[model samples]
Target chain A: MGLYFVAKRFGVFLVIVWLAATLNFFLPRLSGDDPVANKLMEQASLGGYAQAGIAEMVKVYNQHFGLDKPLLTQYLNYVGNVAHGDLNYSIANYPRTVVDMIAEALPWTVGLLGMTTLVSFALGTFLGALLAWPGAPRWLQWFMPPLWALHAIPFFLLGLVLMWLLAFQFQILPIFGGHSPGAKVGLTVGFVLDVLRHAVLPSLSIVLVSVGGWALAMRGMMVTTMGEDYVTFAEAKGLRSLTIFMRYCMRNAILPQTTALALALGQILSGAVLVEVIFGYPGIGALLFQAIQENDFFVIQGVVFTVIVGLGFATFLLDILYPWLDPRITYRRS
Target chain B: MSETILRVERLRVAYDHPRGVVRAVDDVSFSLRPHERFGLAGESGSGKSTMALAILRMIKRPGRIEGGEVWLGDTALSGLDTDRMRALRLAGIAMVPQGSMNSLNPVVRIRDQIGDALADHGVGLKGRALAERVRDLLAQVGLPPDVARKYPHELSGGMKQRACIAIAICLRPKVIIADEPTSALDVVVQKQVMQTLGRVQQDLGAAIILVGHDMGLMAQFVDRLGIMYAGRLVEVAPIRDIITAPRHPYTRMLIESLPSLEQRGGLRGIPGLAPLLRELPPGCAFHPRCPAATERCRSEKPAVRAMGEDATVACHLA
Candidate 1:
């Protein structure tokens, strides 16, 4: 909560990001697969080129990308380049830089995943709180079975079902891609509407499958919090039912839910991988999927590095905000 | 007494168990005069706390006020609707709570907690006025004004209990139920908190029902004491008369069980445990443990009979 505490938390964040970057640099190399050689061999096999000069071509390409350097030297250079915000070139998409690709794809992922995560969290938390509340309507109990059923189904499977029903059978929403195939890419109302329409299916699947989890966790917390003595005292104080429900019960119960929200938000880049792939939305999840399939090492490293930084930053913000949420958590040493 | 401030007649609180209905507080009756300090003392599971909660119509689900009437002045609390009952609480009657450690919301500040009770009861105090009222309430409970900014955890156990008392007296209800209010504090702090409660009660002229098991504290603090056993009140008498001449066998044994400094000897304990409400003896609930229980006591329930001035005992021999 203090400047010193914030500085200390930022220090921890830097250390975590550095460690993640190092892991990113080493993990792909540890896979022991020569991506460059594999690409050239596949091209040669397809084009019916002689295999004799392929070794020479591989050597030339390795030198060009500095892969021919010693492992330690390559690591040092990678770290130095990362410090300068250069993520190197993508092997699959040869001339495009990883940073450029990420910049182009990051907004779509953040917009869709971020908005959906918040919406589901708020909806699920409120519903869950109501479910545990004795004063809530009896009809709210009927939602339990259906919510659990939706939670049990995977988002990607739900995505496919929705696509089959709404997109294929009913022909109501778009089937795939982030926008219309040849629409003019601008900030026009038509362009934004197309993007939103495309986002609907993926967002729905994500929210539906994930809301149950949030609701279940929140309900459990609410039940426990409701049993707390403070809640009874609040009622004894003659507070309005709504006041006791929100300020006394839901307020305490929502603390752990906020923690979960932070973790969920941090994982937003990776969480939508399957859903994005299913819907063919032009988000980071889809880009990461493609990168993984094509063995694009630089792009994969960049995506993973971004996720680590995002998570560290999120937890950092939580640390700063936690004292405000629960006053007992003080930064000053006793 | 000019007139009773609060009267509870034949209050029955029962819990619906799978096997049978458990009468936690069965046909218990008592009354408190204005500015009176009445104590309800009994062993664990003796329905003291249950009756206290029943008085406020706060018996939770699975347990309910099966039949009874709690009258505060001209209003019958038992017949009031939910909204009316809620509004009456903390203004008509308030509770000091049994568990002070968790009675105050841990996440909220003391100022807001006290302010909440005031604002809910239509005090209409805001900003500087609210803060001033909170600080005054805290000071009345012997707490520092700075305690208003602190959370429950920041304060000590006794301090938390004082804060609870502060909230209870914010609207100066006619009746204040301090249910085992000091059960969690050290002996030293317990005395201080009780003294604070006494001062606040005198200032408000509110009748208090101090529910606790500490007979020594009860003898010192309460003007009158009621003994409960197996969901029933066995005796109700003035503190001095009960201490000097306890008519009911259970009351006499409970008084004898208290460690006395002048009589240095082995601690005296009652012969048997308090009876379970679900399977109590047909006649007197305490007959099983009564040294002088007779055939009449074992077969017929004794009605509360009048004793010498202002005392009542439900013992056939008495």
Candidate 2:
């Protein structure tokens, strides 16, 4: 039954990825503007070429971008290129392939956003479990109002306030880029610390806004699972309080968080867009925003495709992990 | 008489509601002897299950043992701290919780959970020894050895109940509380589960307090039974006497409600609902439904009195 579920979900995953890639191929072209003409107009604005030179430039640009081919042939070639793991060039950036731009920005997003999300999930779940523990400290209840308020605020708005207060007013954190402006980039401890220093503000904004959600979700799950008869049974069996809380209640409580973890991980891979933009951090969200503004259709498509694939992969992994985490869940062949 | 394995004297458990205090087990008392099966037979909300939970100190918030002295062999259960209570729980008195299907943790395997019960109480079994004990417990409860590897959901309702019985008797506690253990199961499964529970209890020489509303099931399993009504013990007698010659009006009513082949005139349910705990009727608490209730019965509370050898009743008429 497990193997069948794996195979079935894999088939569905492939189909979703194919649909996303196909949409990437045609949706940009359907905007009713020719890429070659757009490029010509761009150059004309710069006043570099005369009419005859501009015409030649357009012809060369069309061929260079593989836009000179018939639409059907281009479509087939697009599919064939994607099939072989080839991502063609960015029309707006000229000379840089869409894949290379994504590849360059991917690490920054994954590192900062990935680290913050993991930290928040871990910390929030632990705190939430403690808060919901029967007869937990009364003072801990004071944390609820602020956490609820934080969770309700949008990430971008929170990021703006954090930047203004922590970076501008207090001057406790770096305000721009992923590293010190003049620092040499390498494996050196100074460079790594500078990078981490720059990251603190951006990651903190995301963590502050998102941890509340994890805590609230986990606290709710813990409260419900704690009431289950098994928990009482555990207590009745002379198991210690910590044992009942951790093994009986938290074990079941963590199941829902694992599912949320997969989706949250997928989301962070797309980058903490507003946080990145606010801190002037070099990440995929900033790159994607620039591509959208310039009508770099291929770059936009590439970024979106990456997001879609990440989400699908995360979901598939969760589908497999869920049953293993919860014995009450089982797939039926029927 | 054999040694009293467990004793409860004037146990008063109540829930503090916003409106008023709901006396769930209001000044109720009972005792169980070694290897004796004592059943508390009552309708829903009669405080039978609450009384059972009170003995183990398992009642959640909103409910508490207001005034009670519970004794398990020699230990004073009511005064023990949480740590001592934890030590006394499975090692002194185990519980087969209601709806055995969900009594075991769903994420854990059957063997591991049984091992947890063993390990928590300082049973100290580990490795091959632990596995052997788990296998032995399973076999004692009539479950196959391979069931140790499977999850609770993999087993049938009867199987889960049987597994529950095994866990309850694993430490051989002097007294075991099987609260509605077979209620969720079907007839055939209930019979099988109860048989396994009965056989194991007998073999281990454990006293059991079987709490349920089903008088027929209680009669079949227990030799002595207590009939409860509105948080009060109405009658206590041998199961045969309670069935053949009940003293309390409520006991006769309960027997009348049961569908019997011998008394087959279409089951007659008693009139009126069980009292809401927060607003129990004055005096007898059953005067409104009792055929023989008088002004005296309505004005004064009746105390439990000896009727005959091994028979007790709390009704003034008796």
Candidate 3:
């Protein structure tokens, strides 16, 4: 059953990727206005070429990019190239491959945004669990109103608020960028610490906006799960509060959050686009912003497809892990 | 005289809802003897289930045991703190819950469900000992050993009830409250499950409180019977005495409602709906629906008085 589930998910995933890439190839074409002509017109005078020379340049550009081929061949070649890790070259950042751009941006996003997403999930779920616990302290109840208010703040507005308080007003934390321009980039503890210090404000902005959402979701799930008969049975069993909370209540409640966790992890690729743009964080989110402004199709396609693949992969993993966590969920069910 | 293993003195449980306060279980008092099979027979909404939860303090907020003293042996259950009550729960008194189909955790294995009660209540046994205990409990409940490897959803209704029974008896508490334990099962399965429960109680030598609306099943399974109406206990007597000759009007109506195999007629349902506890008439709570109600019955309540050494009834007529 497990193997069947894996194979089924893998097959569906391949089909989705093929559809996305095909759409990527056709969508640009369907927009009309020859891209090569546009690229050449922007860089050089089109009137300088003879009529045959212009056709020759256009054909050569299309042929070099494999765009002159039949749609099927182009799709196959796109799939093959993607399989080989080639995401084409960025038009805006001339000569830099999209793969290269992604590689450069990934570490920054993972370090700051990925870590913050995980921190939000972990810290939020813990606090939420505590708040939902029947025996939880009354003092902890005071945190809910503030948490809900925090959660209601939009991502970019929060970025603005954090910058205003910590950067503009107090002038304590750095307002923008991943690191000081003068700081060395290396394995040394000093350099690493400097990078972390600069990441604090950007990461904090993302965390503050999202943490409350996870906490609220988790608390809601806990409330409903607490109503299940298993919870009452657990209480009736005379189990310790910790034991009951962790084994019985949490085992049931955490299933939904695990799914949320997977989707959130996939979202880490472009983490908080506006916040990254505002802070100049040099993450994929900022790259995508720059790509859109320049109409850098190659970069946009690469980033968007990567996110799609990431989301699909995360969902596949969740599908596999679900039955393990919830024994009631079996692969055989229709 | 038989030793009382569990006792309730003036127990009252009330729920505060938006509509009004409902006195779900009002001033109920009863006692259970060792090796006794006691049945609390009541119609739907008669507070039998609420009283069961009241016995264990399992009622959540919006509901509270307003006035109560429940003693599992000597310990006053209502007075114990949360942690102390938890420790005393499965060890001193356990429960075989109603809706057996849902009582066992669906995701949990039968082994874990049964073994957890043992381990959590300081049984401190694991591996072979735990497995052996699980197998023994399963066997006692007439379940196959392989059931331990399966989940609740994998089991049948009867099997789930059996598993719940095994869980209840795992700690061998002084009293096991089987609240409508067989209500959700078919007649044949209910009989089998009841037999399994009866055997488990006998083997463990523990008392049981069987609460349900099925008067016929109570007459067959329990030694003593208590009848509840509008949150109050109207009759408490030996099962044979109550079944053969009941004193309280509600008790008589309940016995009459049971379809007798020998009698060729449709079932006799009591006339009139039970009064909402929130808006019960002044005086006797049962007076609104009582045929024997008089001017005195409408103006005054009746105290439960001993009819003899073996019976007690609450009625001005009695």
- When sorted by lDDT, best at the front, the candidate numbers are 1, 2, 3
Task: Report the lDDT tens digits of candidate 2 across residue range A40-82.
Answer: 6777788866656777787888897788899899989888888
For candidate 3, give the DockQ: 0.65
Interface RMSD of each: 0.9, 1.3, 1.5
Which CAPRI level is candidate 2? medium
Give the CAPRI rating of model 3. medium
Residue B39 lDDT, candidate 3, scale 0-100 = 92
Every candidate's fraction of true contacts kept comes to 0.85, 0.83, 0.70
Per-residue lDDT tens digits of candidate 1, residues A124-145? 9999999999889999889777
Question: Which residue pairs clash within candidate 3?
Answer: none
Stretches of candidate 3 above 4 Å error?
A43-63, A67-73, A270-272, B17-21
lDDT of candidates 1 onward, in order: 0.91, 0.86, 0.84
Q: lDDT of candidate 2 vs native?
A: 0.86
Candidates ranked, most accurate by DockQ first: 1, 2, 3
List the DockQ of the predictions in order.
Answer: 0.82, 0.78, 0.65
Evaluated on chain A only, model 2 obtains a TM-score of: 0.93
